[model samples]
Target: MINISLKLAILAAGESVSLFYKEQLEYFFGDAVAITAYSIENGSVFSPKNEDVYLVTTVSFECNEDILKYIPKDKHIIIGDVTFKNSTINRLKEFPINTKALLVNSSPKMASETITLLYKKGVNNIQFFPYYPNSMETYSDIDIAITPGETRYIPNQITNILDIQNRVLDRNTLIEIATTIGCDYLLDTKRFTTYFDEISNGGIGIETLIEKNSILRQQISTITKSEGIGVIEFDVNEKIQSCNNLALNLLDEDRSNLLFKVVQNIVLKEGVQSSKKTKNIFQTIYKNKKEEQINLLFIPIIKNDNVAYTYCLIRKNKDMKRENEIEKEYLKRGHYSRYTFSDIITEDTRLIKTKEMAKKMAKMNAAILITGESGTGKELFAHSIHNASERRELPFVALNCAALNESILESELFGYEEGAFTGAKKGGKIGLFEIAHNGTIFLDEIEGMSQTLQLKLLRVLQEKEIIRVGGDKLISIDVRVIAATNENILSLVKEKKFRIDLYYRLNALPINILPLRERIGDLEILINYFKKNLDLNFIFTEKAKKLMFQYNWPGNIRELKNCMEYFCCLNERIIETTMLPEYIKENIDLKEDKNQSTDFLLILEILNILKKSEKNEKGIGRSYILKCLKETNFEISEAIIRRLLQDMNKKGYIISTVGRGGSKITQLGKEMANNK
Candidate 1:
């Protein structure tokens, strides 16, 4: 109520000019500062009633004793690096290439400044000559004239005019102002950190660095915004500065009632004494109006090398415990790349070369397109490339493009703000892109992304920024995208199914993984690796290997893994061609007693399925085998099973019970069945 905000007064040559600069300051600083303007040419008077103030005036306004006596004199800064509207650039672009134009402003200094800014903004196509009121020089050859909302200064002879509207202070000018007013701490806030990047045509001189508490404060903001925690900041004198939504709820007080209120008088418990301004954490327990216990973690922090602020993170007791457990569980399953180039177990010359090339591409920052059949380990290569890159230490987020529908996938990839959609999370969610900042995002099945999503993704690739699903804020991210697709993207593009621009954007660096069949050299090595990894004791006989090599593994490495798993399940030591899966044996000639092997497998399958009968010492009858074989799809009859049993009996693998008495597996047959 004391009006303690900072103040800045402006003195321009005319009333309109003075109000113009004052408007810029008001629009930027908002209520953070109080602004006033007086025109020197109009002989207007500026009387200061408040002792706390700052003055911004040209030498033309002679300083009266009353003004200096009222406010203290500080250092002076000449504002220069001002920025204009981006629409200004767009309007200038409409002019013919290399067209000559005149830039008219209120004064010669302002005119030259505007022209210089235009050139810096890459509007070199248009030649601009500086013009102002009462200038001795004139440009008759220039038919086009541009003004920064100072059209009155333009000569009437110029019919074609482009008004850039008005110029405003750029980031650098605001930084200087904030620093001058001892409000530089605001620059580290989320508002100023993303201030220039958010606004339209917000000029250069972005904040180069942050103070000591910037990162810690950012961490605080992130933690505070999370589901469980609620953060509140207060000044050294116990005056509340800020409180989050959860905090307001937990305190059972509205924000308007809590902010700027003293803790001891209104809300704080007797045990919660005024904390001294130092680096310390104060833990306390309090019962809210709902009769539920809440935990408070008060941390005193020094900002700008001064003990002016402290933070209190509050959470309900039960929620805090649950949140801790969830956090621990999250730590167990983290976002990390599990594979590197060394993990790619490949002996094929082509695959080896592909890995080497991919490793080379990893050092640079660009979008990568991996084309291969499904299960070819495109994600493996993606992980390896990220680990080999400079951003290896950061997160590695993998999302399947085909798994989610359009809206869900968009929300997951780019996140959404609170109240963005129905059932949106309270604080919204941090997207995979934000989580993968300064790292890599492996988008599996990129071709499966809808056309609309592809266009949005193209914008991200071009601008290195993303607007959340239902948010206007532009979040700048430094993520390296590694997109993979099993489909023929070029074909899809030609068919108008996929966007060509997005394809080209993603295909900046391309890697095509050969399917397992084309690189059969790696088959044996991969088999061994999968066997060892799966802890399988089976040995692939040369016949089985031949059959496997003959097969075209359309499913690629993942299919090969499945094949190994199948052998593991069979629990067979001698994996002959007949033991191979039916799919693998397709179109292959097993010529060597293929019938005998088949019969052998049938008997094994019968014995394994039925095992030893309970009431009888012998096994189930041959008719049962015939029944199972027929049920499972085979044209064989009971006579075939009888002959197979007789041959097996000759080998002493089973007790010969050809009559009504069922035949049982002998010890030798059991040994083979058990894979001994």
Candidate 2:
């Protein structure tokens, strides 16, 4: 006699049943509670004896049609038709409007309803009977029979009936019940149909994302073997129906074993469970069959057509670097300096053409200067030039001229003897230029070098040698010099801040790297290149692109990269204009440019007013501003207008408010003008 508080769901569907079952488990094992029930289905609760256990009834209706509609569709229903048993049919009648042939696939609902009604009829025959739990062998030989007199006995003819009831009881335990029982079976119409209108709808709990590492591992293995890179499709069950060889190789798993295994097993390891903090990339895909269809770029596989498999193609989009694959490359040990010319990202036509020129000059020991805005990848170009040259076999060293003071710069560039300065090595310290002998020395921000140090560098370049700081020993060295700067060295020379001789020596061949905004023609190519190579979906709306184009990017290429990363962190597909940072959105115009010949200043004023207003207010405000300008006949200079406003405010003829201060038709000013 287990005192189990079993939760029986009578009229629930499959999804509801699953939830109910989960709740029942928590209610039981979570609190050390127990449950025992005659029927787990909704609307079926029976009690023959009260032996340390309580009996509870719950009504559940499983119907392809509405329960209320089904109840009124039939008339003159049969009461206790035991032979006409079917799970889909509602046996008990709740409504008297109509009666149809009732579906009674099981005797549990019918018997419970009949026995309940018969109790009022003074028929307690079945209700009072004490049916004890017994083995299958014992139940197989037993049967229940009602004698003509006041008596009941187990008979041989009812052995199958007893066995069936016992089996149902065994399966009806609270923790062991199946979803199909509550979802499909025991749809008694009597209690359920009556209560259907009264029950309130409360939604189920949020579903959790389970780990799927094993599945991903298998997919990776398949992709690796496929030897191609392209998009692939998988069904809801993660079955690979059709995929190009490229997509298959991207997954790197055996296609045969990968499909059979669940995605959870491949991506998330079997034993090591994932925590809630772990992001489920495939959550939307697994949760819903429709609308949740995923669009992900398979690793190393470019997803050209999200719906179909395609041929393998190498990603030529340099700016569109994928974080995941890049992370993999970065984490590998001891490969920092191995990055070559192929790794530099640039879409600038001038830069591309400069790189070709650099390649030809790499054979010579000629000094070169790469000039660009900060983050225009000057050092990157320097590295590529060094790596492509004959000095590639030698160690390539680099130093930032702006990062250190003159003293430290000199010590760092040239070696020091024992006790040369404070904390000098006992033996000696090797300078960067000495160590870079027979190699390349990349001088970044050469424009920031001090005039005094520039003289020493010029001496080194001319003499092709160096002298130690403490020791006067002259050490002749062979090293190629590559200088880079974000500043205008010619202007620095004019200001006497930089040595003219040093500038000429280093600026032998000046190459300028263009800013990102100047290469707007390559924006789409760069964006798509990143989309194809990266596992993310970062599509830009037309409005978002307009916003991007409107700004004068002070940070240049670096700012654009940061903005892209920021939006990517938000996991957005179509980056809308609204999602941009405040500075970008506030300063830039996201609308299309009209070709009408308006003065730049007037246009700027119009744009500012439009931006300050909301979407609904923009049009009205623009009209007002245009009308005001037309009334004035555009005669007033903007400066004169400002002076007039100041005078008006000083005379108390107009009042201005903070946050949004603008000139208006002041009542006193208008009265004074009318009087005149």
Candidate 3:
């Protein structure tokens, strides 16, 4: 234990470097030490403070002796043990095999030492050229520069400078300080262990991954007797180090062929290529020789965010497969298309023509984007398109992007490694893309996907491969994507909420289905079909037919189906104008007092604004309207504005056009605003 509170000083080349180390030193020693910092860049190196101990930045640090000249003689000094932050080492590993980056530092020796530190941390992937101040080396061809918080020394040509945010002191320096300050007993505390763990593995905080290997073996032995899980341990080279009998059983491999062998799976390709690329725990699906589907969980024994050893746990898949109603013996997994082009019953030429276009598009392998309002049967069209395609015999997986949140949606769509993040699945799960390989994946409400996910999907479209959430292995897929969105995706792209390149990739074969209101010619046939499908012996009267024709189906086909269900529940054999649902009836009823309603009032205000802006080429947009409404303490959403504009256009009060034309107030709209 320290008899007195010790004072220490840190000297570095720059202010940022000095302050960073100063804070680190203070945090390391806590209240037991008083620390001061000085830097040559800030001209504070000669402040002339007598200190009990001096910590030079690094062993390779120049002027280490000169910096001490300002201090009192015979002071206990330690050259700091510096290392790259664990985060920097992980980032360095992400660079391609031949990626070149300039490693900038304060001095030539410091640069070389830092590069060595990176190599020691297992960041040997990138080719890092050392760059220090006034070094006559031109790295003009290199686009990226890496530095340990030394950004000012980076050359002007390098635009993408990744600052690893200052070199941090290694556990050795902390121990050296502890011993020097008579506080060596602090080494036994959890706080010190936590710091040590962070310096080792970026705060994941396990002293040795060898403990995990032992724990995994114990788990394999105990777990097989109970849970019947199969586990295999593999090294960075993808060579099998250990495998239990349960694993051999799952793999259907004989003992003579399994033990101490390089692993080669007939299915799932071991779910991972090289364990060296794997940094986090992930899972994939594979099948054994018996055709029994199994889940392979690649649990990485990580050190400093790099996989040292992978513990693969195999569990049986719960989904069963068998031949179904198809003539060919198809693997029935409930991921098959339920509709063909014949199922899309429509009398309208535009719809029939659109269906024909989609059917022709199905023959091709390019991506498809289906756009329509909610209840416009976009998903129905997607299913029909897939069934019409050659992949109809294969899986047709569908995912509603809007239904799940970002995390759940990501895992559901792309699949994830077990323990990818907090609350991740235990055994891990297969993604839809993996399940839909050699078939079609229908992403419903594609607009609802986050921009981050959009980029991933774009990559999948381009590369025809997917990386599971928290996984590194590229799983190749041959899938035809059919993405549907109820929202105007182009508007979202213009708003920067969606990626434009993703839009083009998906919109390769576009299908814009008309809403029920626009395609009313097919409404009667659809109505009767729905009634017959529900086994309802119902008929609508002439007055009811008029109301149905006049009233806009806001909920579209889904709302109409529910409306039919409502009538069926009412025990009505005949549905009249008075028997309609409130939502449908409200349109007719609300019209009488429409002038008094707040929505109508807002509509009137918008009409006046549009009337004024009618002379403009672009007219007026939702933003200007929102801005105007906000000025008057009115709260409104863009969706509500869109609905209002759509209703106004339908009523002939406004003429709305796509793109830059925006919406223009009609003569009727001017008269309506005058009424207000």
Candidate 4:
């Protein structure tokens, strides 16, 4: 006999047939396998200890990508018994043409894939409704209902209901078993005969198999010996057949008293009954003799369409306290931003319109992509939109994609199962997506996200779900995604750095914020707003104001706020032009020639020409500037004059609109011209 001891994790095994499949696999492998089953609905996964461990997924077609995220393709064993049968297609065909049907499955993704499959298989006449667990009441329009198991709800309009049973053990079981066990020739005559005999001729029951196999017993004992965990096994009649030492100690009952006792007489009796009825995993809290709450998980094991045995996994509630603390820490870090639309202090008409459009967009649930230069308040807009939306009461989680490396970013966004990697948390962590459920997730610097993560994010946006790292379960989330980027996302897509599909999905409601220099009209208002918030009594001199307006604010509002804070820290009642930051002064002076007097003359002459053009109701172009320079008896080249005009525009002496509109003199420009 092969000495291979396999630890198999079965994912999405909540269905009764899936449970039956699990029992069959266990029975066929006998004592050589230790199985841990998980339901995708529960959003929990069992972490395998080593690379030698195997993973099997009975999840629906849509969840294949999700399962693949956690398990390597080589390590994943595809059990053929988990799939639905062609009878489902035949049942759909029985319906009249143009019939409206509701396809109910474990998840929305599953239902969607099933509908697509039906259509591909020539059942296009029926309109299918993807299952929405929370919106079952709205399913009254459903004409027919098709489900993988018994229908949870039947609307009056649903005249026909079809329960499509998934095959428990397909003919490919031998091939699956051989592949799963790493055996090369289990299909050979001798090996196939032995395997067939073990499965067909009164296979050993799970309890008997464990009792007879000392190695299996030792493995179970070793696992159950972990501190703070309790395990118990019961027969099909709900009689406790075996209880680990941890369970005995935790329940405050010895084996003599607990063994052979009906499980309904013990703790979690109601949960056991519920799990048996539904054939689904259930959890409940049980109070021990010490009045301490214990978390109990009831999992039923099915065999030949009946419950063969059930396992009760128990742990002290206190064991979860640490995990809760970790979750709370992440929650604290994901607190909602207090900003609102009213907080965006701006007088610029274009910016006001943009804000209004954004407010309207917020009322809808589509994804929004905000594009702007850095520090242009893209995140501010994201916060304001979230606060104004219907989901304002929920969290506004913001993460900078560029701030972390790919590995850390993936873990923070999607989270991970326990032992997903080195130094992982004990019970795994809840990602920002889970934390921001029913709210908004602002992904700033989204262009910086890796291509791999972009594809994952695209799936989440499309499917409205996420699967944790090292976990096969799909967690549904209802979050409004607001992705922001300083770079041009379309350009990145063209460059093949970002996924084009994701770009289009996120760009459904695009909002572009103008840079500070383009919105100079808002500068004075922003300055006063920052000053009032800083509680500064200082007043800016006319020269100081002119100097600020003249310098191009490359850092936008964020830099302006910093400048205001620095001025307040100086404690000066009156702020002068010379008191500005050295860099600002240097930048201003750099625009002029080394000869300050000559530079001043050049600026004055250009302002004069622009002011004349304003009087003439005609903007001054480069050709006009050359003519004015020649008339002023200045021997400057056309290039020199053009450069001077550009410099004067940046200095706020002129406003140059795009196209053939040319440059026009501002009121500040007039003041400088008259003063000179």
lDDT of 3 by residue, 1-676 (tens): 5444678888787777788888877776677888888887787777787889888764323443355557676787676667665666777788888778898998866676666566546565676777999989897799999988789899998899898877788765676677677676577677776665566642211112223322223223333343456767777666777777877888788777755667666442445453345454466677677988877766666544566667777777653431122212225458888988887778976777578567767765667889889898888898998888767778898888988899889888878888898988786667878788778899999988988899888778766788888999887767889999888876796588987557656765668888888888878888888888988876664457878888788788888888888888987655656678777778876243443356667887899888777778776877888888788787889898888889888878888888756788988778677655
Top model by lDDT, which number? 3
> Candidates ranked by lDDT, best first?
3, 1, 4, 2
Q: How does model 1 fare in lDDT? A: 0.69
| Tens digits of per-residue lDDT for model 4, 279-324 | 7667888788888878887777654456666677788776456446
Give stretches of model 2 more than 4 Å off: 1-338, 344-348, 529-534, 589-676
Candidate 2 displacement at residue 473 in angstroms = 1.2
Residue 154's C-alpha lDDT in candidate 3?
96
Off by over 4 Å in 4: 1-331, 590-676
**What's model 3's lDDT at 384?**
91
Better of 1 and 2 by TM-score: 1
Give the lowest summed-lDDT range of ten residues in model 1. 203-212
Residue 475 lDDT, candidate 2, scale 0-100 = 77
lDDT of 3: 0.73
Q: Across residues 381-455, which tens digit of lDDT does each residue of candidate 2 receive? A: 888888887677665778899899988898988877888988888876667776676678889988778878898
- TM-score of candidate 2 against the unseen true structure: 0.38
Stretches of candidate 3 off by over 4 Å are 1-333, 590-676
Worst 10 residues of 4 by lDDT: 206-215
Cα lDDT over the full model 2 = 0.46
Tens-place lDDT per residue, model 1, 238-258, is 778888999888877778877
TM-score of decoy 3: 0.41
